[model samples]
Target: MELSKIIPVSKPVCRSSYPDNPHSLCRRFDPPLLVCFSCKGQHLENRRYYYYCATCDLEFHRGCHLFPPEIKHPFHLLHPLTLIFLDPDFQSSRIPIDWPDSSSESDDYDSYEENPGSYEGHIVKCNYCRKYLQPEEFGMAYYHCSTCNFSLHRICAYIRPPLAIENLKCHDHTLTLFPRRVPLPCDACGFSLDTPFFDHVYSCLLCNYMVHRTCIYLPRVIKITRHPHCLSYTSSIVPSCELACGVCRKTVDVNYGSYSCTKGCRYALHSKCATNKKVWDGKDLEGVPEEEEEILEPFLWIDEETIQHFSHDHHHLKLRQDGGSHENKFCEACTLPMTVSDRFYSCIKCEFVLHETCASLPRRKHHPVHKHPLTLFHPSSSNPHKVERKYYRDGFFTCDGCTRNCCGFIYRCSEQDCEFQLDVRCASLPDPSIHDCHPPDHPLFFNFTSGSVMTHHLHFFIQPHHFQLLLHHLHLLPHHLHLL
Candidate 1:
């Protein structure tokens, strides 16, 4: 057998050196022919045999039959796994070994073989339960299992991708996916993403801010403190002279982001302090709880049973209609004036009365706008009363639960180390509610309360009613209600 007769002599030669000529009588050898293992059909002639199954007569080309060495799965985003072909002798009989529906002989094979570059194939695995996927289930990534509902795309199963979160501007970094398992902070919103993340992780280099990749893009404007106005972001620092946030009574400073009025009328908040969702617990105040119900002796027209209040502490507290007073009476809780009210909480001792709406505020709260819980605070905890120089001060404190500023009546933690606070209105809101004025069975609760009156109607009316009903349903006394 002449080797030159069968082999093409003018083919582009490879760099490797080979024998120029072979003996003419070399046992009449012929190149091995490659065939498909399942059908035993001739796939390629004259190629090195790769995949050979003795029990089921088959063969494959070396290049055509190779598997990937390492693969990164979306389901397991933390680490990349190596692909290993299962051996026949392995004990796991449940594992699928064969390709699906390869019996359809058609002319498409010729086209695919001719244009190998255009041919595409993929491998998949389950996200929840680690199961190797069949080729037929390639496109059904989005549709999850009916029983277990574990479904994902090959890319999603292998490499966890990043999702866009809103509003929450994490510390200095933009949140992104974590490559390897390392204790890193989120880039977009400063949070720890070390816990169980969905599929993606956000990280930062400068600070210890890490969070879920889905938590990066939080909403910009949010409701907080149950105020009529919507709290808008202010890039500038809060005024130092402002003392505490209007919602949570925490110290407003330059370090954290602040929310304030565009008109700059002494209204300001720490970004996290303003969005508290609960009422303050009275552990932070220094004085003992007042027992006696105080009613104005001058306005004492009603009987003793009808009047319920702390009479010894207050001098001139009185009941007034909502938006009834022209003169701005400073609130004992927030040290502000009563603008609108269906009811009012007044101090008979010092002519101080908050709007009825303001009096029924909460002590602590949790907000959607913030990641953590917040407490409320009153004004006079540290600072003296601006109105009465001789009177003792009592006010709310802000909780450091979230990143909003304290704006309205606040709920604060008793712990000196933890200055957590939430706005009174924020704290008093329920998770869900049904209203008489609005549609029946309508799920309502205190959401965030922005300062803007035009857009935030829920804070003005819905929040007040919601708090009142909650107090009534909880079986709290009117005096105890003031503690909210």
Candidate 2:
């Protein structure tokens, strides 16, 4: 018979037997096919079979079969292969396999009549890193190397499967592979993991925290009262303070973590402050009503040509056109040197004048810790019990927000119901502020008489003059509310 049509048979090959059932043969339309030792066979698909080697075309469905055994592989000239009966010792038996040189045509089986000795002892290679390893390194159906820490199962090495499942535990939404780097922070800890880390992420819409796919299962509701709304990870940038952070008390750049507002106030909280438990008492106080409406007045009257600022004790303060001359002038607020340009207050009579920085001090402010708002006082009233009074004797007011003494200017409130106050510098602060400038949408509003008093801290009261100045700078003309 011709070798191609012979249908090579094994010596007493094993097979699974089924009870005389007519439907068994009919059900085997697509029979389980197997190849073993240069021979192939077709068996019933439902049978319990084993030992079908795809490399040699030999089939063995039952356990009782034994066939002629070959001790050596015809293709391998140097190394002899062996059959494994049980768990083989990989540490001692592992060996590397070499590929035939690309230039050697003699290794091609079709061209050469004899065995090419090229397919005898081949080892599997890792698909990801492309490193080859010995068969002994793979003990079971699949295995991995402990030394290099490279790993893959037999099916895993050949298959390119998706890395993530549809519903993972870390997040509420399905996680997809993040093949590219994201510009925002992580949804979990708010850390910037845009570097080399490979994983999935879930983003929240309420705060700056970006959670990784694994961190999505973490609790969503954190009990932080510093913010009026519950904090969540969001993509929005928040309004920040001009000075250091109010909570961590650390100076941070604006690009870091930000808190979100639920009231649509366009306000953002610092990450630390967002998680704080202190609640803010929501109270909006209107300015005190005047018995007879006083005509609104400008804080200072100036001529078109030049304006001079004079102190009661000073002879005269002449205005200078050069801003560089006032570069080193002192600010009335913190008593720091004024480095800003454009204007200054001078008394020509006593040759004494306040810089533009001193003249810009705020008259009122509200603090988180204070119950009532504080006001700015011209030659601020004496508070003998308070340490700030010592500095107040020199016509300076202490900032109720920070409790620090200031000389540039001061603010105060007259109503005994509201105690809130601020130094000139603190009171002039703008809402929804960024550095020195305030956003236009949320213009500053001033309250002089019944200055708004926060309910949480009744002792703190809003100052009117500072609020009025801030409004004036915004170019908002006062109607009923008069400047103090």
Candidate closest to the true structure, highest lDDT = 1
lDDT of 2 by residue, 1-484 (tens): 1111222332232223222521111111223534322112234233333344333334542211221222222122134322221123322221111211112123222222221123235455542333343333332222344334434333233232243434333344444444234666664445554534433444434333354553443332332323333434333344344433334433434554444443454445454344333322222112322132233221344564234332222233445546566666653333444344445555555434455544433343344333334444444223544424433555544555546555544555443544445654445444322111444333222222234321121233344344444455554422212132
The local lDDT score (0 to 100) that residue 328 gets in candidate 1 is 60
lDDT of each: 0.38, 0.37
Question: What does candidate 1's lDDT look like per residue over 1-484, in tens digits?
Answer: 1222332333222111123831111111124534432223343332222344333333433321222233444444445444332222222111122212122222122212111111134344455334444433322122233334344433333343554333344445454444444445433332334444433555554454554544443334544333433445544454457554555344566544555553345666654354333322212111333233232231333342222232213344456656456246655554445555435655545565655444434334444433334444445433342212222233323333233343444555434444444445344444444444454434443333441111122333333423455445554423223322
- How high a TM-score does candidate 2 get? 0.27
**Regions of candidate 2 where Cα sits further than 4 Å from its true position:** 1-302, 305-316, 340-342, 357-375, 380-397, 417-420, 434-484
Top model by TM-score, which number? 1
Judge candidate 2 against the unseen true structure and give its global Cα lDDT, from 0 to 1: 0.37
Model 1, TM vs. native: 0.28
Superposed by TM-score, candidate 1 places the C-alpha of residue 372 at a distance from the truth, in angstroms, of 21
